[model samples]
Target: MKYQQINKSLFETNRAKFTTKMKPHSLAVFNSNDIYPISADSTMPFEQHRDIFYLSGVDQEESILVLFPDCPKEKHREILFLKETNDHIAVWEGEKLTKEKAFETSGIKTVYWLQDLGKIMFEIMTQCDTVYINTNEHYRANVETETREDRFTKWLKNKYPAHAVAKSNPILQRLRSVKEPIEIDLIQKACDITEKGFRRILEFVKPGVWEYEIEAEFIHEFLRNRSKKFAYTPIVASGNNANVLHYVENNQQCKSGDLILLDVGAEYANYSSDMTRTIPVSGRFSERQKAVYNAVLKVKNEATKMLVPGTDWAQYHVEVGKLMTSELLNLKLLDKADVQNEDKEWPAYKKYFMHGTSHHMGLDTHDYGILTEPMQANMVFTVEPGIYIPDEGFGIRLEDDVVIQKSGEPNNLMKDIPIEVDEIESIMNG
Candidate 1:
């Protein structure tokens, strides 16, 4: 792993929370993600399955975590099946985690190789009455490729047809949504690195700078800070390119008097930090530009305050729509009639601010959380609001990750990253 070691207690607490929700005598299994193939002899980088990573703190491939909390044998209560390491593997590939190291990393006492998984699982299945199968259940999930979890579930169901099946996704959705303190610390580490990258770019960006140049600067900073790659696809959009919400084609010059929309973040130890900020190529916002920019900034500030304990995700967006509506009115982009006749599903604010105001943030940039449920403390979320004005030849967006609090307001994780116009301008010019 490129990043520093995460505490095993985080996984221990996560497993306790998950197993508490399981039916008595039920067992849950989590599989590591496959190293997907690109072509013959080529494969994408390995990423640990979030479910397994959440439960055991094991960030390796060919691993499985079986939690049979009510197992007859206490040693089988929490087991880890890892890929067997050998001298040949050490010479050819690299150091894989040995049993002792796996125990140190995961806090699980009993560890076995993948070859022993079937035998142990058979014994476990015969002892347990139900099995929890992990599945991808994020609301925006559109996975066309069958994942390792899918394959495991298929085989497990076929092999143990008599066992009662339960979905691990539902239990995980609620449990993972509420962050542990250690998980919050890891996410904050990612955000802190992202802040460093953003500040580096603020100094690097100037007139005539190409979009890809900015992207390179961010990656350079992220790598030096122990990040593997971007949290998601980066968008280094300059001028009108900012209007395209998912713009990633970074192949244009940043003209003076225009703004660059940097939608980039870092991935530290599989945790994500999402941020978006528009900056001037000339290190100063024009009168009209500053008005729109400050409006979006105000919206982001107010919208984040809505992310507190017990806030409804749906209701929060509606309130944010009203705030954006007023901002658009002030920006002269919308009138009373536009809002009066606007469809309830798609409000007039959609004309300028087309995307959702925020989403849950943590492991995945759009991390899993039950949107239908009320918000809870320690749940991290991104409060991003933007106004894309193609007609005006520029767009503005401001994003910050925040942690929901029990009182007052949410705590902004990106608070150290400069967002104020004066501060950004000063740093850029200084």
Candidate 2:
């Protein structure tokens, strides 16, 4: 982990919140994500499961957290099972967390080696009437691979068929959506790093620069600032590529007059900060580009204000659609007749700006939140609104992460990053 150790108190509070929602005599388990393989000898980087990291702050692979608040034995109430570390392993794979360090990393005192998991789980399974299994129930989730959590769940269910099964996703969805003060600070750190990267690109971007070169600059800034990697697969789409929506093939050359859509962010200590900023390849937007840019910015600003407490997520988007419709009409892209004759299922504005304006932003890029529920304070969301015009040869998107406030407008986490037309141009030309 390139990031500094998070305070154990955050994990402690998260575990307390989760346990409170569990049924009596129930034990919830969270597993670390597997280091996926790419080929025979190579493997994708290890990323700790966000659920376990949220509750226990255990960032290493092959780790497990179990919470049994009603356990008869006090020490067994909260437990951590970690891969055993020793001097030999330390030389080969760097320092793995020792039992003492595990206690410091997580607040759980009862730590055991991974080999003892079956024996310890068997004992706890007998005592608990219900077992809470962690599952991916995020709204946008379309998982194809069987994760470590899946295998562990299958094993546990097979071993203890009589135990009542319960889902941990619902409880986690609500709990993880709302940020704790410490979690908010970590996310701020990520947004701050992203600001540095965006600033770096502003000066580096120019005609003939490859999109991948811009991607490299962002990663360089992120790594130096302790962000392990991008919050998600970065989109460094230049010109017409931006209209593709999820264009990650950053191989195109940025033309002199084209706009480069940078849908990028940095992840610090497993927390995500999502941001999207489209800028001119030549450091100056044409009159038409400027008009579209300001329109999208207008929609983003208004949409952010609607993220106050008690706002419904679905209704918020509908209102945002209305805001965009007005902008599109002013842009002359949509006429009164177009909107009147448009299908209700897919609004007239969908022709240009299609994606949702915001989503929960936290540990995962598309973080967990029940969209049917009303917005709440401390919940973070990305206010991104874009106008894609392949006919005009460019796309414009401006996004900022914000915290829903108790009153007035939500707080913009990326406020320090330049977003205005003149500011971005000044920095690039200066």
lDDT of 2 by residue, 358-384 (tens): 999899999999999999999999999
Candidate 1, which ten residues in sequence have the lowest lDDT sum? Answer: 405-414
In candidate 2, position 370 carries an lDDT of: 96
Candidate 1 lDDT tens digits, 233-274: 999999999999889999999999999999999988899999
Provide the TM-score for each candidate, comma-separated. Answer: 0.99, 0.99
lDDT of each: 0.92, 0.95
RMSD of 1: 0.9
TM-score of 1: 0.99
Q: Root-mean-square deviation of each candidate, in angstroms?
A: 0.9, 0.8
Cand. 2 Cα-lDDT: 0.95
CA deviation > 4 Å runs, candidate 1: none
Model 2: clashing residue pairs?
Answer: none
For model 2, state the Cα shift of residue 177 in Å: 0.4
